[model samples]
Target: MEAHLRVRAALLLSVLALLSLLARSSSQEIQIVNAERRIDLTSHIVKVFLTLKVENIGASPASEILLAFPPTLIDRLALVKAAATVGKRKKKSYLPLDVNPTELPDAPNGTKYFSISLLNPLSAGESATLEVLYILTHSLEPFPAEISQSESQLVYYRDSAIILSPYHIKQQTTFFKTPSTKLESFTKVEPTNRAGTDLKYGPYENHPPYSFSPIIVHFENNNPFAVVEELVREVEISHWGSLQITEHYILKHAGARHKGVFSRVEYQSKPSFSGVPSFKSLLARLPPRVHSVYYRDEIGNISSSHLRTDPRKSELEIEPRYPLFGGWKASFVIGYGLPLQDFLFESPDGRRYLNFSFGCPLVETVVDKLTIKVVLPEGSKDPSAVVPCSVEQHLETKYSYLDIVGRTVVVLEKINVVPEHNSPFQVYYNFNPIFMLAEPLMLVSVFFLLFIASVAYLHVDPSIRK
Candidate 1:
């Protein structure tokens, strides 16, 4: 009996060993031959572009590549996209690959991973070059946290000097493009150089997997950090040849908080230097043939606005009642009308659809929370929305002019919205042409009844003395 029990235990141990070997073999070992990382700190948004030459070092083929990021940046990351280079050097083309968040088993240092699946598996010792673009929102921090109206706004950005990767890095370099050459300070890794507004680091030697060198740079960046805390865009579709849009914005200066009282006299006198970071006017790009544009706040319509239109596009420049300084906020509304034929179309199967651009129209602005409402015409049914990314969607009901049962409103909500989210989205629904007569017919019937009542009263002569 003892011998049999020992035999069973040995078999179990052997099985465990085989499973471990299989797991290790399945995980491909990769090495980064060369990497170039460019960090753009010219504005409040952080844009990182990475070019990596990767090789599969393991015996097995690599079907996927992993990107690592620290916990601090994972939440702020707004977009991640990667493409692989194909063909020869002069004729090189890029094929976009699928990127999605993934979990790495037994990952150390609380690192987050995003997996990019390759179209073709990379064989052993084979190399491939990849280009990656990612954007982060609200990443720059105001170093002083609070500044007076006259002080130039300076901000701090923290990042790893080394390219963060799960694989071994044979060679890597990082470059920084600052807003200006007025660099207060920056961390110096050996072989770091600064030329004009650009800073370079690395050309470092081989680094083991998961190596990291934290660095920070402090510099003057007085760009307006215009951020919309909450934006609600309402798009109302009318079959009567008009597409109306109204946007409500709660905009704020997301830069350093203001410390002292804002003096308008000082700001106006020295317009060039005083309150350099503050913003008074913002430009919005509207679709072509836009009409009936209005910019207003709670008080009334703002007169300090200009509209320029051409055959292709329209621009609306608006100024708030007061200049927006750091931490200051303003709430306003912008509404416009577009010809229905420009955006609404009817499919062959008798389905009507509306293709509209998503996201805010203001330039270089980030939205913390966005809600888009598409109010279809009354009597529409089976409404659907097609957005590029995931968003919270639900059905709502809104009453408009001469609406009988209220219009079907498709509500889409998303957070951490960037300008890249401005792609076109389609909303399709089944609408009947017969319902178009509901409003006009109702109006005529009411007018006819009124006329008939007037005639009856004239014929009856209901005066008491009659």
Candidate 2:
């Protein structure tokens, strides 16, 4: 009988404990719902649907709803597409995808369901979804959204993947056949979902455009979105593994956050702008055994940047053109020397020739109209040179430097784009192994010929000339 009584007492205590736990968890069952997706190609934009799901623990709907918004993915998508739409960046007030980051410690009982999206900014409802739609463009997606009073913004591939292809680029009306300029051809684009996030790039079937797969670089990407209305990068490859690269950056603020006229005071006083680096300047890595680096631009000199290298680690660190702000502009230049041996590559048959031509990108502009010219090395002897692959619709020939007719020149022009030009242009040309060497050879040959002529002239006796 005593044993039975103990069992009954234990069961009573267990029941009481269960009731208390249930009371505590009664408010934790709130859920969010109403997720949607939308894409507008007419304007070139995308939007996401989000809603809150709240369950009434007290069996009663809440009196009000308070929702917190997050701006984490804003730069990667919606806002970026919107920036591509229209000619210029849409006013932030007019933009559909602007949202502030929100954190909710504990949701109160009076609040109910919330619907949010990039479209609708705010709504008033109890136990209902507050949906808002968002929009973005490529340039705005570049980060460091705003910098301190005086700082440069550094921008590059932050949230996506790269797809390279191997193909001889097109030049005006012909093709330049070469190996170095081949693209890492891409075929198809694939996207996968790993939870709430979707990824697009590759398990990579073959290569780029064909064999190459899209390379997605998703990270905390704190860099700012910037567009240099102008940029000039000159790379010189010389003897003894010496490579010299000069960067001239003319940058303008291209962030999606600019709402109205510029605010210099607010931008300058901001602590982040004063300390953090913007995407305006970048980190350049050179081959081994490089020394004597310089950074400058059209503005003469920028003191904000510095460079350092450790012989053991063999690394090159560089700073940017200017401190990036919400809607400001600046220009600067930089130069660094690298080893020539590192640049020398060998073919299957073992041949040597100087390869110095590379490429730049198409800067999406709403203003339209642009002129760009690429100056190749003096001895780029091939009669044909492959042009860069970009949004180029028309191209023309320009003659300059030294040539019988003129070095093959290509001019590309187009407008109304956001920021896809950040990629490199693939170009190739069959270098004249013999002719590329001829410039210096010809110079030496001329010098020797002149010397011999002088000697002959002196030895010929003035009497013979008379």
Candidate 3:
């Protein structure tokens, strides 16, 4: 009877051990209450916005949360901004977050992790909301990857339908916002929702942590995804003349490349061919006070441009010499003049200030690298500048027409800039009135000296004749 009792006791001990292990596993997993993802697809770039409501179901307080990206987009991901708010409050107070990369064995191949540190440690059963914004470059690949000049371009986009979180998700949804409504085909997951140009996927429930559902979308986007490989914008401030703004762009088509040599005959034979995803023309909006404008390419001035001016605003439309195809390049220069009074302000204390904006490109585009050089007037001192975006600034000397002393050139460099960054920058400096008069005085003095020498030479007749 004692032996039988021992066997039963051992079996009960084994069951208890198994239950303990299961409880520990459940406690270690974080719980996601909700996940909302928004993806905006432009020509070549994709912007992702994710908002997650999470709770720490672990036994200990959680200090960091992990965000995982699919293997395809891991290398192209760029974190823009991230923030978090604690609990449900009438007035939400957001806290800045730090994002760093991490790796987990269970994640898919090429997966990258963004570890966000919480401002306050999330106690067990407590929840926090996180908002993350990021960009993915070259995410949309052409369906054929290469097309003829007369073919319509279709792009293929693939991503995980579910948010790759390292936690149990109670509910989740994804919305895809495209530039056009002409969708050719998309993988239809059940319980999908669609409205206008947006495709909403899921209200998925009871998904285990770290699960992934691959989704592929094909859409007809016959639009030029103009990508400025390089941009050099120069802003010259002059006390006498208008503010001269010039931008030189090396523009390239980010869509699929041509399979064979481009045929001008076929392209012209089809009048509808011009509407394909090719870079044909761009329209830029100029400030109302613009005085002069010009557009030219590397070969020479392009005459196929038009300018329309009104009392309030002006527009400059320009077309390239040839339709830009994938992998082909075109370089062009555009410049305009804006009145000084529009940007420059004078204070009673003789302090000068300037406010100006680098307007968007003529078309929807992305700039890989942008360099802005602002040349201040000669002898300007105590210069201070404020730019809307993050930039690398440096001071240089520039010598221009009739400049006695070199001008102060403020060089600002930025990367991964889009057309939406159309905000004005403020620059304050101290300008002496005497400096403004220096150029005029020098010109007058030179002319007077030349006149006197000319008169003296004329008076001295050819005495060699005697």
Candidate 4:
């Protein structure tokens, strides 16, 4: 009996060992041929682009690829787009891609993953290129975090100098582009180069997968980093004559807050105080042929606002009631009018259509949340809209002057929007001609009935006695 039990145990151990060997041999590995990372810090927003060449080296096909970021950046990161292209195609057509976050057991704190699925499974020995674009919000930190009003501001940014990948990297390069050429300080790596406002790092070779090298950059950026916490843009169409646009903004200064009370006398007397970090005014470029421009804040009209118009373009310059220091908040509204001929169209089928476009705010900044509402004429129907960014849409009705039926309102909401989203949003809708003339026809009928009633009353005269 003992001999039989020993034989059974030995057979089970041998089977388990064989299965382990098979699992190890069948495991697949991916190789990164080259990587390029570009970081642009021109405005208040920070943009990052990554491109990679990858190959599947295992026996089986690769259907998915995974990429991760440092735990610290997971909350501040917003993915803009991701795509992939198969081997060396000159025409440059990108494959459809879907990205989602995946949890990693190794990085327990927090790690964001970008998973991309290929249309055609990447067979063994086949290669493809992958590209990723994203934005970093509130990533710039003021080195001091609090500064006096008269001091020049210095901004610091920290990031990885190497590409983060799950596959072995054969070669890689990183480029950091700053807004100004006045770079104060940057970390020096063994293999790096620089020219003008661009700092380049490596064509590094033979790096194990999932490697990281941290870097910090300090530069002179005196520009006010304004962030619009929320913005509401409304467009009201008046088919009778013109189109009106109004925008309300909740703006905030994103730099370091003031440490002490501001001294107006000291600021005026010293030339050095001129370098204080505060937002005084903003310039907005309006569409051509706009009129009736107005700028005001919660307190009332801002008299410091000015409008400049030429044959070529129209500009509006507005000054806030007070200089916006760090952590300070302000709210304001700006409105203008344009002729209807610019946006209305009549189809050959006798269908009336209104097409309108709205662009981003004129201020060079980032908007965390934006809501745009377009109000169409009464009795409008079958409305449609197209916006370049991702948005949630809804429809509502609004009542205004002389309106028998409320106008159709289209509301669009977007999050984490940047200045590059300046692409105009186009909207189209149909209007009934009968509804357009309803108000005029009703007014005429009321007048005609009143005249007839007055004549009848006069014909029936009654005598009065004193």
Candidate 4 residue spans exceeding 4 A from truth: 1-30, 56-67, 70-75, 82-110, 115-132, 179-203, 263-273, 306-313, 345-359, 445-466
Mind giving the per-residue lDDT tens digits that candidate 4 earns over 183-302? 888987768887888999897888875677888988766678888899898989888889999999998899887778877677667745553678878878877798998889888888
TM-scores of the models, in the order given: 0.92, 0.37, 0.76, 0.77
Write down the lDDT of every candidate, Cα atoms only. Answer: 0.92, 0.38, 0.80, 0.78
Model 3 C-alpha lDDT per residue in residues 83-119, reported as the tens digit of each score: 9975567877778788777655444566667788888
TM-score of 2: 0.37
lDDT per residue (tens digit) for residues 127-179 in model 2: 33333443444522334454343443323222222211111111101011111
Structure candidate 4, residue pairs in collision: none
Displacement of the residue 253 alpha carbon in candidate 2, Å: 2.3
lDDT of 1 at 402: 75
By summed lDDT, which 10 consecutive residues of candidate 1 come out lowest?
A: 19-28
Which sections of candidate 1 miss by over 4 Å?
A: 1-27, 88-90, 459-466
Model 1, 380: alpha-carbon shift in Å?
Answer: 1.1
RMSD of each: 4.0, 25.6, 10.2, 7.3
Judged by whole-model lDDT over C-alpha atoms, candidate 3 comes out at 0.80
Count: clashes, candidate 4: 0
Ranking by TM-score: 1, 4, 3, 2
Clashes of each: 0, 102, 0, 0
Q: lDDT winner between 1 and 4, please give it.
A: 1
